[model samples]
Target chain A: MTDDKDHYIRALFDISPAYDDAPVFQQKVMMGLTLKSWLRQGLVVISGLIGGLYALTQFVRMPEWSLKGGGLYTGSLQMATRRTDATVEAGVEFIDIMARGLADSLFAVGGYVQWMQTPQFFWVSFALCSCILVLYLLNDAQERI
Target chain B: MPQSPGHNSAQDQSDIDLIGRAVTGSHTAFGELVRRHSGALRTHLRRMGAQSSDADDIAQETFMAAFERLSEFRFEGPFIAWLKMIASRRYLKKLKAAQKYLFTDDATLFETPDEAPPPDMRLHDLDSALLQLKPIERVCVTLNFSAGLSHVDVAAETGLPLGTVKSHIKRGLDQLKSALTVPNSSSHPIASSQNGAAGSATPTFMDERR
Candidate 1:
């Protein structure tokens, strides 16, 4: 009885109306595909343009010491090494001051504040923010695609 | 009436070749696939209790998804089966999104009139017969019989309990049999006793593995 019922049901569902709208259906699907492709491509191009514009802005704002070569490069490297040593010293001093107590750490805190105001710090912060923004935009665009 | 350009050429290529081209981003090849399978898929969705407009929408969404995921197709089965699987999943998603609580375990919620008079067999098609069933029952039966999903697969697909899926299938099958079975008519023979034929109404691409 189960087998007979299954057979009858299969045959019944098999009797589908002959639809002549295949061409129209195909056109609709193709149009959807094309539109999605265009949107995805447009997103990628927009993301690339945003990234390019950000890079160009950063390039325009870049310090001459970072972009130049020869004497200025050597001087900048030396200056960067000195600044790194000074930052390390300040960090150690801040930790030591924290270990002692918070009251005597004004000079260390001032040194850290001065370090944060430097051009190198500003460039680093700008680059990090730009990278994060680009990555976020790319991720959003990929999810949309 | 003249056929579209490259229509004959596209038809000559096998589904595998068309899939390969579609994977490489050939809209024409993918369009051929859509042209080939849209009718059957739309019909399957309609049998699964989707309105004709909704069926077409779901079919279009399925094809679009298939195109995006063409590379994931392993070529281990018929392309039509893969397409149907996507369509079934899409339809289920739409059903769930539209009706948040459609697939409950309550049998009483899906009860049909068992003692109702049989319809005029001449005018009674499967679509109308399917309407006699509850939405969940129609979905379960169509997934099992039309979309070639097993009871467990249907349960997994619909997120319903196994017992509920089984009951739905059983009740849906009973209702369909009562509605469609011709009294003392021998015109319809059991087409094929195998799982492949029993799984699908129109046996275009029978994936026995399903």
Candidate 2:
């Protein structure tokens, strides 16, 4: 008899009301997931930008200090303004000199750039970008559906 | 349970497949899951005495939390069961925060006994029948019957003493039987006896002795 009562109660509980708000509920949950995804992606992108900027500054500073012995900043500024001629020939020559100096700096920093391309850094960057891209595509696909 | 409109289209995909997709950041898969189970979960929460708005809020929180921790979910059980567990815990947490105690001798708990809805009104549906029970009793009964949790599991999940959980379930079942079965029906002798034993008083743990 007790078993019967239990069964009856279970049966009663099983009778779910016809809830028609599932679409609305699903929309709310999906909206929540979208918001969370965007927030997470935003954090990742912001952190990556900050880290990349810091690393770039460090890379640029290290090479300048090592190659030029701390005179690169003032020296470049003086060189660029030293030939302030109104003639187009002088301006062209000044730009040519600046471009050559930039090339020299790039060559000086070649070792550091190669180090950044090593397997460890390359793989880490690849994996991070891949994750972000996959997340973005998934979110976009879900939104479209 | 009534399926959402798109439930059929997603029915071809297994829950594990959907979960795998969701884990990889598939919102469409997760949305399908939400569509498939939200009705039953919402109904379960309502049976447990959660107001409609509270049920929706708790259900939303449960799904959001489940999404955040989808990787932690083991594949040993049905996905709906996992969803129900999440929703139940969310509802219980909300209830605990509001009421502080799951079981109490507060007079409000007994108010329904004296002001019992008419028999016809109570028999209108199982939800109405459940509403006749105290909050604790309703939770215990719903967890046991609706969520299909064992007594031990319900006690553990509720953080209530096992004995208290059992008594609440028994009393709750008795009240529900009395409310649901046609009054004075000879075929259901147990229901009739339970009604007599229960009387028109606020249920108390003390009454469990009888």
Candidate 3:
């Protein structure tokens, strides 16, 4: 403990403190996982909602065809193609097939995209689960302590 | 076998008493562990060449890990020795990460003239001289001087054999003494060489109460 004065340790202590990792990174990850969980839940909720809306659509069926000359005669499958528009008349041959095909295509695309997102959904879910596990482990370790 | 709160059949009552008290949610006892051990831990990190910024986090993690594994603290010798080993290993991990990030507390992190340490050499140059040492030399210097750990403790912390720790400490200190004496800065003050006294050879740790 010889005193000569002017040591840097005193100054070293004065130079500002720096932290290695950002303080909020953990909190940000926690919130992101929560938002992702809700979005995934929203997908399932929206599917049920849209399914209910589709059931209501059945009550208001689309006309197979319309006759304009006689002024709005409702149509059926066996009715002759007597629509006013040439395009509508021409499309009569493939109307049912085209409508069914388009609906199928839309559903298929939506399902594929959802399936692709499953891994991301699962990872967010796993992160949340791990946080729970860590919380539990901390409790369990404390109990033993 | 039934025993009173103060008495137990378990081996080494001293360890059991401290651990049992800590286990029973004794805050003061745990605080005892922290106050007793944090200094040596900080020293261990310094040897690992970690930025002081990382030291407290590493120190906190060290205690957290120790408490997590409190059931396993054998308490065979000095608890400081045990803590030093854990902190040293953790510091190595942090060092690897720091290297990857191109950010380290070591004097090596700076480039050129700015890299020079403060001119005054009166205080324990032991810790700062550590910045000049090779990685292995730094670790060795940490275990002996900073941690005040025995050679065995140094070996245990580094996972090197006891003989290796002894040799590194002996050689490392010699090199450190020589390096500190060199006049790196003409502007740097050290009483202009003649006034500079030989470092009285600190006997590793100054904090023995731990």
DockQ score of each predicted structure, in the order shown = 0.16, 0.19, 0.02
- Tens-digit per-residue lDDT, A59-137, candidate 3: 4433432222221322442166665467776677477456556655655544444543456755775687699679979
Q: Give Cα distance to truth, residue B39, candidate 3, Å.
A: 2.7
lDDT tens digits, residue span B13-80, model 2? 87888899889877878887887777767777887878778788888878888888899889988777
For all the models shown, what interface RMSD does each have? Answer: 8.0, 12.2, 14.4
lDDT by residue for model 2 (A84-143), tens: 656765766667668667767765565456556457776787799799789989975542
True contacts kept of each: 0.37, 0.38, 0.00
State the lDDT of candidate 3 residue by residue for B56-153, as single tens digits: 56766666666657767787866665666677667765555555422233536433343555676423454556666666666766656544567887
Winner by DockQ between candidate 3 and candidate 1: 1
State residue B36's C-alpha deviation in candidate 2, in Å: 1.3
Better of 1 and 2 by lDDT: 2
TM-score of each: 0.67, 0.65, 0.40
lDDT of 1 by residue, B154-198 (tens): 999999889988988898777776776544444564332211213
Query: Tens digit of lDDT per residue, candidate 1, span A65-122?
Result: 2211223212333333454567786765566546444422433444444555568977
Q: Please compute and give the TM-score of the first chain of candidate 2 against the native first chain.
A: 0.42
TM-score of chain B of each: 0.77, 0.75, 0.57
Which has the higher lDDT value, candidate number 2 or candidate number 3? 2
Candidate achieving higher TM-score, 2 or 3: 2
DockQ of 3: 0.02
Better candidate number, 1 or 2, judged by DockQ: 2
